[model samples]
Target chain A: MKKIVLSMVFMAIATLAMAQNATLPQNITIKALDGTSVQTSALQNDGKPMIISFWATWCKPCNRELNTIKEVYEEWQEETGVKLVAISIDDARSANRVKPHVDGNGWEYEVYLDQNQDFKRAMNVVNVPHTFVINGKGEIVWQHTSFVEGSEEELLEVVKKAAAETAE
Target chain B: MKTKQKHLPLLALLLATPFLGNAQGILGGHVTGNIQLDGQISHADSVIGAADVPEKLLMNARADILYTNGNFSAGLRFEAYQNPMLGFNSKYQGQGIANYFAAYNGDKLSVTMGNFYEQFGSGMILRAYEDRYLGVDNSLLGLNVTLRPIEGVTLKALAGKQRYYWEYGNGIVRGIDGEVNFNSIIKSMAESKFRLTMGAGFVSKYEPDQTISYTGNSAFRLKLPLNVGAGAIRADINYGNWSLQAEYAHKGQDPSIMNEFIYREGDALMLNATYSQKGFSANLQAKRVDNMSFKSVRTESGEMLYINYIPAITKQHTYAFLSMYPYATQTTGEMGLQADVMYKIKKETLLGGKYGTDIHLNGAIITGIDTNRIGGDGTLGYTSDWFKTGDLYYADASLEVAKKLSSKLKLTCTYGYQIFNPIVEGHEGNLHHNHILVGDLTWKIDKKNVLRFEAEWMGSDSKYDKNIDDKRCGDWIMGLVEYNFTSAWFVSVSDQYAYRDGVGNYYNISVGYNHGATRLQLGYGKQREGLLCIGGVCRQVPASNGLTFSLTTSF
Candidate 1:
């Protein structure tokens, strides 16, 4: 046990020292709302910044986060040409309900299903309500886990930054 | 002492190389991962049926580290359970490198060596995955390969042994799968109204033989198939506004502990259809299974080493009381059906004031298969009727309505009825019928603050008995209030009280903070014991009076 702890401490230090920028993974398979197999590498927002959210139907915080984003999505898109892509990590049992639930909630966002969680594993997402910010180059720039009432505003700031970088 | 000495140099090398890489940032690969640490402090409470915890403090921590450079990547997960918390498997008592893998991805081929997860069509015959919160990780420790020789075609092959606690299971599993998209392959079909895809998979397991004596007659020895194989085929068809999917799987006879060493061949079939437009959608699903409990090891039982997945077709409720009696999938012999519909009322109408109102209706039913034990020892276990259902296992029907009363306020009401049979869990009792109602309200106080409230009530025909340990068979009331401040901090309080035929009050308060990629939460509560399920897979969580803390971060 003591040796294991010592090894863990060394690994932690090694991880901290090797920190660098994050980027989007390629060739992972996910499903569209229509149940078509789509590759994650093909996802694009027409040179605009994009936000990807990992969520599930039974997760309360995930629902809350998406609902909060829906309230200001239009304005955010108009201002920065931003797009939010909501990805559900629901398995086969609940995967069928995702479409109707999205329609009922009246959320105007691109929704996809990660039924088998292949894409989630590739991106190293630990939990739901995890959000990622990708620039126009399709590189992951920022990310945050969990949601609070005002976190959307911070996300908007990151989107604006990515958009500005593209403009430059 | 030998193992410790062997690890010393590796540790020193790991600690020294990072500093060397730090000096040359351009050559250093990008590192990304996440960490989750959960700690619990509990006390014995006789009223709640919580057992006295000798350790008093328990912690579970895991850290994943991935390094990616170009098309090559490697990752490892370190897990530690300093005396696992209640509800977790006691076998996970120590710490080690639980999982590690190296993979290379190219345009046409991908290869992974070491721990990995994979699932075939509908996971009817093969699925190896992990659910951390449930303490279930059945990842395969071996080699997996995926090839895309042409557009819209994917081929996957894997061979491995499943992880069991800290060691690998005693069975070797091998599988191959292939999927093709008809529309994408042919140019003319790309623009056609019909889109079709087909897939098939075959999985086989090999285990060493074990001597088995029949329980009914101890003098008789039973024969067990050393090599068990299962095959599945699936298809998906989509047209304008409509889609359909179906999968069928069949397995050769294999004796296992779950079915009392039955030698019956297993089979499963699942069918789903959906129709959707802008504001309306409908879905129907049906499934049947006969002796379909596929595990990696023949002698293993419980939630570990499962080689296949059987999905329960039921409505997964989100409300507290509505989900009190969540159903568990009966994989051995069962038939189930489910239907769902959703419609939205447009704004500016009688029922839709300023914003639209949404209505959702769902229903599901599951039953046991009609079977007769016809064989003696050392023979096929039973014969089952193909089209007859024996007894009702579970049934549920629910309707939910959500409306936006104002720009800042939203209300949702739900009503549900459920009938559950205790026989599903090997208990002999009358069917329990329950009615549940829930009202939820959310108010956006301003741009930065929000508040939400929920009230729920459940009335049941089954009365709780002190002799019976299940606390869910009773009338109960629950209420919750959550407040959010500055979008970065939140606090919530909730309580559940058994108003009739039961005796217990579960109360909890939690506070949380989130910033960037880090989140921290703390709670103090009295938890009621129940079966916590996710997507039909369940684990028993014991009652506890405790303080809990969780911290998660990613870089």
Candidate 2:
């Protein structure tokens, strides 16, 4: 048990160091709302910042977070030229419900389906409502999991910081 | 000392990671993973039928590690279960590297070796996946390849054995799938509003023949097929705000225990249609499954080794009372339909008040496929017409309305009605009819503090019967309050009481803290025993009086 603990401690440090600079995984393909395959590499905002949120149709917290963000998404885009992509890990069972749910809520963010959670695994997202902010260089700058009623405010701050860093 | 020797190489590699990080110019890659630990301490509760646990504490833990460089990636998952949880399978009590895979993903060609998860269109014929909460992981261990020789076309092929607990199943499964997107390949169609994509998949399983004697006749042997196959075709079409998707699957004649060893074919069809715009949306779905239980092993049963998936067309309700009697898809033979509509009232209107009001209505009905038994065992089990319907299995309808009462407060109300047949759970009882009501109020006390309150009532016609031992029956009332503060910590308290014709009171209190990508949650509660389901798959969670905690982190 002690040796296992020692190895884990070292592994944590090594992983943290390697995690300093990370970007989205390449060559991963997911499905858009229109049933067309989309490459993750094509996710960009013309050198601007981007926000990626992992969600599911059945997750109440995820729905709340997305709904809250929908109210201010236009403003966020205008202020930072930031794009938000909502990825649904609803699997085949509820994959069909994502489009209708998103449209029902009248959300304009780009939506995709990670039916088998390949992208979710690649991104190392343990749970829904996990958000990541990417800079102009496609480098992940900030990340958070779970959301509260007012968590959107903190998310905007991170996007702004990332946008500002890209500006420099 | 021996354990240290075993991990010496791993330690050395970890010690050298810093130097490797310094060589970013050469490797230019990163490492990422997630860790989760869940522990439970439960004591016997005779009222709820919670059995005494010999092990004072049961824990399940897993760590996933991945290394990525350009188009190449590799990962492994180490899992440990000191003793399986109440709902989980005991076969998973040991610990090891449950999953590992190395892959090269390129623009046109992608290949993966070792263990991997894959799914065909709609997962009707092939779906190798995992759901930790459901304790269902059927990922295949073998080779998977995908090719995109031209734009708008994807081809995938895989061959492997299904993962059965710590060992692989005897059956070898192979499948190939292809999909084409018309809008991407044709220039004229690229800009058109009408879009179309079609996919087809074929899967086959091979297992060595096994001898089986006819019941009560030792001289007669039942001949089992050495190979069974299933195929599916799917299409997705979208025009303007209207969209439609459909998939049809068929399986060859294969005798299995789930179907009483009937030499009959199996088929399933699912169709979905939706129309939506900015403020309103409508969706309708229908599905029919007949003897479609396709498992890797002919004799294997109960939530594992399924090569095909038949999704339930029912709303996965969120409210505690509304989902008390959830529906699980019947793979042998069932038909169902669901309809959902959502509309948002304009703000400043009387019903909308200061903020817009959102209204959602959903309804679903499921029934057994009408069939006439022609013969049993070695012969065609039953015959059914496509349009005929049989006994009602489940039915539910719900309506929800959400409106903000003030800038700081929001309220939502839901009403649901359900009719469930106890036969689905292998029990014999009168149909249960329930009426449920739920009210939720969320108050944003401040920028970083929020308080939410929920109250629910369920009135059921079915009374609690000790013979059946189903805890979900009887009239029940529940209340919950949660407070989140400092944008990081939260506390929740809830209680459910069967005030009429019931035997138990379940209460729970939990506290949670989240920091960045890591979260720790602790709770003490009396849990009700029931089916914990995801999608349509379910596991029986035994009732327990316990303390539970989970910690998860990702880097």
Who wins the lDDT comparison? 2
Q: Deviation in angstroms for B406 in model 1? A: 1.2
Tens-digit lDDT track for model 2 on B208-271? 9887676647798788888999999999999999999999999998898889889889999999
In terms of lDDT, the poorest run of 10 residues in model 2 chain B is B531-540
For model 2 the local lDDT of residue B546 reads 94
**DockQ scores for all the models shown?**
0.41, 0.48
- Predicted model with the maximum TM-score: 2
**lDDT by residue (tens digit), candidate 2, A35-150:** 99988998998889999999887776787788888878889999999999999998777889999899988889999999988999999987777889989999888888887789
Docking class of 1: acceptable
Query: Which candidate achieves the best DockQ against the true structure?
Result: 2
Give lDDT: candidate 1, residue B82.
86
Off by over 4 Å in 1: A1-19, A104-108, A148-150, B1-28, B216-218, B529-543
